[model samples]
Target: MSPGLQLLLHDASGEWSSAQYTFDQIAGLLMRRTTSKAQDETVAVAGLLGVDVARLLNETGQDARMRAFLLQVETVPAAMVLANAPARLSFPGFRWAPRSFGGIEEEFVRSAGVATCTADGLITRRELTILSFPKVFVSNSETSSPDRIYLHLPESGSLYAMPDLRKLGGEGVHEIDAVIIFPSAPETPLVARQPVVVVSTVNAAPGQDAEEPLECVYRFRAYLGNWSDRFRPSQMYPEMFDRPPGEVFITAQRWSRRVMIT
Candidate 1:
């Protein structure tokens, strides 16, 4: 054998310590390196996944491509999702998902919780059990609040939306769906009550119709505050803007049917 190959084999064997790193971790590292050098991400992903590159490239449907990529992801600790800034998913259906864990932003959520990728991973449907409110009036005021933010939502009935945030498109009150998420278990007292609230609004991408079947779906936004009679800034919870959309969703129910991808 050549000297270079011989040296490589020797060094590889010497570094085969499971305590330091498992085979999967090493393989993942190599895959990232290879992907960085490769011109096409799809080709690189397919090669590492042992799938037919030609078939994957030629696949016309976006859903097929998304399914092929998600099927090969490692499911142990719930395949890595929600990459930090500068690293984001660029694929068709996965644009909302992150690419890798970049430094400190990796603490967005505990786990992705076995994502159920469907409709080519573009339209992921996860069951969430949260405190759902029919409507909320979001407004930015210069009043006495800590953050100068005010909000009002009913407990049993729906109310008119007070759209004061300029980013929401219009100036009038529009009805929108809102829900509160508990990052920790229900037993935690510091944040035992609702700390993180998210609202689901219409997909407001410019030049794109709201009813189109194409990419760019609904936006899930996180806010830090509390509500007894009104909304006020909370000191208990951390900043939740960096949390992944998939991680924010939590459910105790299990799927009745199993999907085995072979």
Candidate 2:
């Protein structure tokens, strides 16, 4: 028998009397259910095993035995899933406003060299406008609130974004690059690194035809930070400015919310 299963069986035998009733109930359910195959069978196995494991791990005077048993069970998928699944990233809270040009819209307009007439004064024209989408915010924990910034690339028909960093200055200023961390597995607990370039600051403008015209193009570079590590490449999306004709010209709105990361 495999070392892992041997350990499980040994532990089960040691706790047989206490765990028999629960294991019998779970085994009965599995035998009676014929409709579900893989899923139901897996659940039944986990249920039967989990009861014994929990009793041994939680009962008094079973510390050393339980610890050894748990060490062996750590390699099991069912045990790992039940143990650490709660800490994984789930339902990340943050909305992306690609169309409305949220928060960064004003910066995008200024970067695009679009002049806006205001009551106080007229804004000067800029060389390029770049906008990042899906501004992330801290939704759950107060202690750790990481922000993710997404950049929209019109020319490539894609969007590039990252968490934990943002551009420092406007167009024609200092060039910026970002390093992102990727995890291999939920249980591995190691972070892999990748580098992404912050392209130029050009923004797309509303065109005369149905599709929005390409206002300007920006250039950026992406390099994986750690050579030995592997990570999934960032995703890209088609040009979002494609709109039907006759759409009214509206000034882009700016996102005002600020995120602070220590």
Candidate 3:
């Protein structure tokens, strides 16, 4: 295990009286009991409307991006890969507001009308937990890499790294193995660390669960990359789009592992 990962596990296993749960309890709480009501509705609509999930998504635009993307995918959080792409590029459907990653998180909390969520309530709002230099990778293959991308926060003048493959040999190169520390987290902020970058999110429709509570089957991780222009994808790569969402999500889950403890 990388020191960073070990540090995060140590932090996670620390004895904080607040926002803590046993691994089993965490599993129990996160486990799905019945099918999601939203999923049920989507399937029903797709059947009655005589359109497949993919078709419905293609026909629609930003207004329904989140739901539509989730419906069409054949996998889990991996669906967020495509769903997150638009946001990564600052696309309208996913951008928190008018081409930005900030404030979108607060939108979810307010829309949910939740002052606090979960038992301990540290999860004040739904925000994309940005992971830079991610470690403790788990996936089907030993060489698998989580799509740990990054974003630049012009407002704060921060340069975030998304475990950038483009910067494998850069100077002052930092690799965080076991732990992730978020210095600027809003709800439950961890001590901020340097080599920090910016924001990322699920970048889906806003105020989704405004009516009632929701079962958060998946949490999206967005990386507002802060790499120099040279060390970045010259253009969005088509190859990255072809892989299974589940596989990508498995990698992402591990990448986001440390941050999700809250």
Query: In terms of TM-score, which candidate is strongest?
Result: 1
**lDDT, candidate 3, 106-147, per-residue tens:** 211112111221221112133333333223232223245443
TM-score pick, better of 1 and 2: 1
Candidate ranking (TM-score, best to worst): 1, 3, 2
Of 2 and 3, the candidate ranking higher by TM-score: 3
lDDT of 2: 0.25
Each prediction's total of clashing residue pairs, residues at least 3 apart in sequence or on different chains, is 3, 12, 16
lDDT of 1 by residue, 152-217 (tens): 333322112122233321223333343324234435412313233233434322234423322222
TM match of model 1 to true structure: 0.39
TM-score for all models, in order of appearance: 0.39, 0.18, 0.22
Model 2 clash tally, residue pairs: 12
The prediction achieving the highest lDDT against the true structure is: 1
lDDT, candidate 2, at 230: 23
Candidate 2 lDDT, 1-262, residue by residue in tens: 1113322233634653323333223333433234332222222243335424443434333223323232323222111111111111111110000111111111111111223222211122321122333322222232333233333433543333344322221122322222111123434322233333232222322222313222211122232222111212232222333323321111111121111000
What candidate 2 gets wrong by more than 4 Å, as runs, is 1-122, 132-146, 152-262
